[model samples]
Structures are given as C-alpha cells and as structure tokens.
Target: MSTVDLGDVDRFTVAALGPVGQRTFLLQCRSEQTVLTLKVEKQQVAVLAEYLGRLLRDLPRPGHLPEDLEVEEPVEPHWVVGTMGVSYDAELDRIVLIAEELVPEDEEGDAARFTVTREQAAAFAVRATRLVEAGRPPCPLCGGPIDPSGHACPRTNGHRPPTN
Candidate 1:
C-alpha cells in the first residue's frame, strides 16, 4: 500500500470537465511541491461539498484563513478515487481528506491524506455548488435535467406537451 501525505495543502478543489451529464469530475489537491489530481464521481463531489460546508459551520473559528481561493485546471488525474473519509484535525486546526485510489486486484492501492484550512474548505463548498448548478437546467415537466439537445420528459410521453 502506498500513501501520500499532502501535509498542510496549499489548495484543494473539485472540478468537472466536458459537458453536463457527460462530465468527468475531479478532486485536486496541491502543495508547494506536489500537485495531485484524483478522479471522483460527480455525486461524490456534491456530497463532499455539502458535508464540508456543514462541518465548517459547526466548528469554532480557526485563527488563520487562506488568503486566495483559486482552483487550477490540470491536464490529467493521478488516480481514480475509490473511497473517501473526511474529518477534522483539532491538533492541526484543519479539515482532513483521506482519498483512496481505485486499483485492480493484486495491485496495491494508494491513499492520499491532505489537510486544508477552514477557509479553503468553505471556498471549495462554494465553488462546487456553482459548478454543479451551472449544469443543465431541470425540465419543467418531469424535473429531470434537460440536455442541450432537449430531454424526452417522461411526463410528456414523447409528445410536445403544452408549455405554460
């Protein structure tokens, strides 16, 4: 088993590539010396963002906050995420993300454990919300996402229903 300890990470964020409904989501963590990108499910990203926001809101304020909130776009991912764990480190005064890599049987999987400041976590939540909301709008008839090419709304039964 391999482990990457991205101690006191400089930046962390979730991003999606390609068009909505056909997008590839990613979790990126960076330090001064290392940049790591991990492939993650879009749903996972959404859940994490919500959880992080709640966690930060509940915890007492940490004295120092990260000054900048910018996420960089990188070309490739180091690994695809299999499982994840999030917790607070009281001693370090940071939120920790433990991301395990997906690997084939007989191969040792890698795990990345990184810590981010409260401010960074909050910013990540905001960015993730925006990224998710920017996707395809919901269909009025069935409440499902409407693709650019239009959606076959179940409520309409493949017919052009009257639009209000």
Candidate 2:
C-alpha cells in the first residue's frame, strides 16, 4: 500500500484480510497519539501461529468514539477489542471501522458488530501492556506474570501473605 503523512499519524493500509481467515497478520503500531492495527487473513495468521500471544495494543481513532476517550488523559487499563477477529455486515459499518470493511462502491443495510465497555477496554489495554512489559523484567507486585499460575501479587488479588 501507499504511504501518506497526515500530521501526527503516517497513514497506511498495513494489511488486507483475504478470503477464508488467515489470522497471521499480527501488528500493532502505537504512537503518543494513536494506534494503527495491521493484520492478515486466516493464512497469514497460520504463518505466525507459533509466536502469537495476547494482543498488545488496540487501535483507537482519537476523533471517533465516546466522550471519555476524547478527553484523553491516561485511560485506565482496559480490555479494548477490535475488528480484527470480529466481522460485520458492511452496511452497518461505523466510521471507525469503515477501513476494515471496505466496499466496492458503497452499499446499504446494517451489519453485525461487537461493542465493549470502557472498563473492559481499559482492562484489555492494561493486560496487553503487561504482556509487552513481561519480556523486559519481573514485576515486584505479581512476580511479573499474566498467567493465573503467577498470581503472586498480594496487593492485586490477595494471593500472597501480608508482610510485617
């Protein structure tokens, strides 16, 4: 795809999902302002099968969405889902998701879609951040692990003992 500069974000169509469901495309580019999601269909997903983990970032268009995100301080850790795995009826495509569900000459009708609460989105984002941070070092609070087995932080879920 071609690249274009639009002030803060360098716009580009990273990948296109072909037929079937490759799921190989695994890319999340984040800047101070926004996040750009890139992914492949079932084939590409199969290719990257070995190194796949939890999602690291959720691409959000600053202009679009609820008022809270627009106010933009530091959003609480959220479990933000996206159009990656989800599919819709093209007609009901929102402006935020228009790019993902491109049509030939535009069409009519609504489509199936998935929505998430702010809290849930925040939680997802935090989890993704934790996963990325995991590769760096161990966290004192939880012994640095996302898996339930590493539920070591007493402060978080009261899994450990109280210190003197």
Candidate 3:
C-alpha cells in the first residue's frame, strides 16, 4: 500500500468542526510544506487522547507543551481513517501516529504516519480531551448524549424522558 510519511511534524492536532453531536472530527499534521489531514470519529479522538495520556505518564515529563494546537484550514481530509495505531519511540523520545484509510476489505488502503515531540503529544492529548468533552453532556443514567431537547434514557423505561 502507499504511504505518506511525515517524518516529523511542525504541528499536529485533532479538531472538530460544526456543532456538538453533529461535528466532523479531523486529525491533522503539518511538516514544512506538507500537510496531511484525515477524517476521524469522535470516539477515535477520545481514545487517542486517553491512550496518549497513558503513554506520556510512563515517559519523562514534557518540558513545554506546544502553544498552538489548532487545526489549520482549508480542513480538507485526504481520507477517512478506518484504523489507527500510536506508539512511543523511546530512542527518539517522540510519539508516532499511524492512520490507515477506510477502504473495502478487498482493497489496499493508504496510510499516513507522523512523529511528534513529547511536548506536542502532551499538548495534543490535552487539547483533544478538551475538544471531546466540550460536546453534548452525557446522560447520568444511560451514558448517552443528552440532547438539547431531551434524552430518552434507557434506564427510564419510557416512563419519562430526562430534559437537560
């Protein structure tokens, strides 16, 4: 399969566009003149943040987190991610993120890989966590999103819908 290797990124971030519960999540990386953007799911962003945070906990503390973690526009995505993998490169003290494009099982999918400094990774995790949390609040009973109108919580057994 083809691959886009962004050896080291000047900036890397996850961003959500549009309103909460109706947002489009994106993963972006920029290295010099090259910029790569891929579409990702909301759950993917949440899990990535959690995994990155866990990974960083075992490594040396970041000296300084990146100041800017915004996703650069035009916001076009190269492909939608079907699967992703992340790992820490201890020797280089950097984090590697690999995203594979969504494709049919019989087809070969493209891949993008990038490396980020510990500082960038830390900043990314923090920013991503905040972004994911900024969405609609979850129902205490059913663990599903409580809409602006109301939530038909499964635990309610259709007796009453909770209004947020």
Candidate with best TM-score: 3
Best by lDDT: 3
Sorted on lDDT, highest at the top, how do the candidates line up? Answer: 3, 1, 2
Off by over 4 Å in 3: none
Residues 14-117 of candidate 2: C-alpha lDDT, one tens digit per residue: 22222212212233333446544543232333222211222212333223222222212222212222223322222432111111332244533222223333
lDDT tens digits, residue span 1-164, model 1: 89999888888877888877888888888999688988998778888999998898898864555545454756399889988999998888889899988888778899999999888888788888888788777787787778777777789898874332
If both were scored by lDDT, which would come out higher, candidate 1 or candidate 3? 3
Candidate 2 wrong stretches, greater than 4 Å? 1-113, 136-164
Mind giving the per-residue lDDT tens digits that candidate 3 earns over 62-139?
998888877887699989999999988989888999999999999999999999998988888999999999999888
Could you give me the TM-score of model 3 versus the true structure? 0.94
Per-model C-alpha RMSD = 3.2, 17.0, 1.2
lDDT of 3 at 59: 92
TM-score-based ranking, best first?
A: 3, 1, 2
Going through the candidates in order, what is the number of backbone clashes in each?
0, 23, 0
